[model samples]
Target: MNLGARHPGTEAAWATGEYIRHELERAGCRVWTQEFSYRGVRLRNVVGVLGEGKGPISLLGAHYDTRRLADRDVSYPTRPVPGANDGDSGVAVLLELARALDQERLANEVWLAFFDAEDQGGIDGWPWSVGASYMAANLPA
Candidate 1:
């Protein structure tokens, strides 16, 4: 999946979410996405569940949205960040762990949360952690 910039509210970011959903499904997760919108821009938080234990939940999370603007880049502050490490790397680690962790030996339910709209802070008055906040507020009991 060649998700170019993965800025929130962009095609690349939506494509990246779909890619994550596919990866999670391949990793044996029951996957779904929490849909929401920020300032008229649609976003989603991809969630994957492993193990059916009714005990405490062990949640692993990572934000998948890169910054909309590379403010720290002196030469190209208006451009979006590549986020190979900032956003993509965490998703990579989570996918690997989702595939590697043995569900049969689990003590509690595990949740893999791929959050969106997180990295876009200060650009066009956007806020950080928007997807995470939405998920946390509406997580199923």
Candidate 2:
């Protein structure tokens, strides 16, 4: 889940998207990948939808990207962090929640989105919620 690496770009982002898609599908949800581009770099936003019909759709989202290797740490600024808590942990929680919702047969449509490029461009450039920003911008108006 290291979306921040040397020239990771779309490959790493897509890999994480695939993982989320697989998990959501396993939970009996219809999964879709929303693809977009930022700075000519292809990025993906994974959306898993469960249930159907009208009313407001509830969304749970988390970014699955890590900082570039250059901004990793002070000692090893060029190395990528494990991002267990930063990346995978949130996704894991969401996945579990999706599963639980499925088991309980929730009524409302639940959409789980994993945004890409959220952690890219570093703290100075992209900021913490770039993926959220992307999601907000592209969500149904």
Scored by TM-score, the top model is 1
Across residues 21-45, which tens digit of lDDT does each residue of candidate 1 receive? 9999998989988989989888999
- Which regions in candidate 2 have their CA more than 4 angstroms from the true location? 1-10, 70-72, 121-124
TM-score of 2: 0.80
RMSD to native, candidate 1? 1.1
Q: Which stretch of 10 consecutive residues in model 2 shows the poorest summed lDDT?
A: 1-10
lDDT per prediction? 0.89, 0.71
Q: State, as a TM-score between 0 and 1, how close model 1 is to the true structure.
A: 0.95
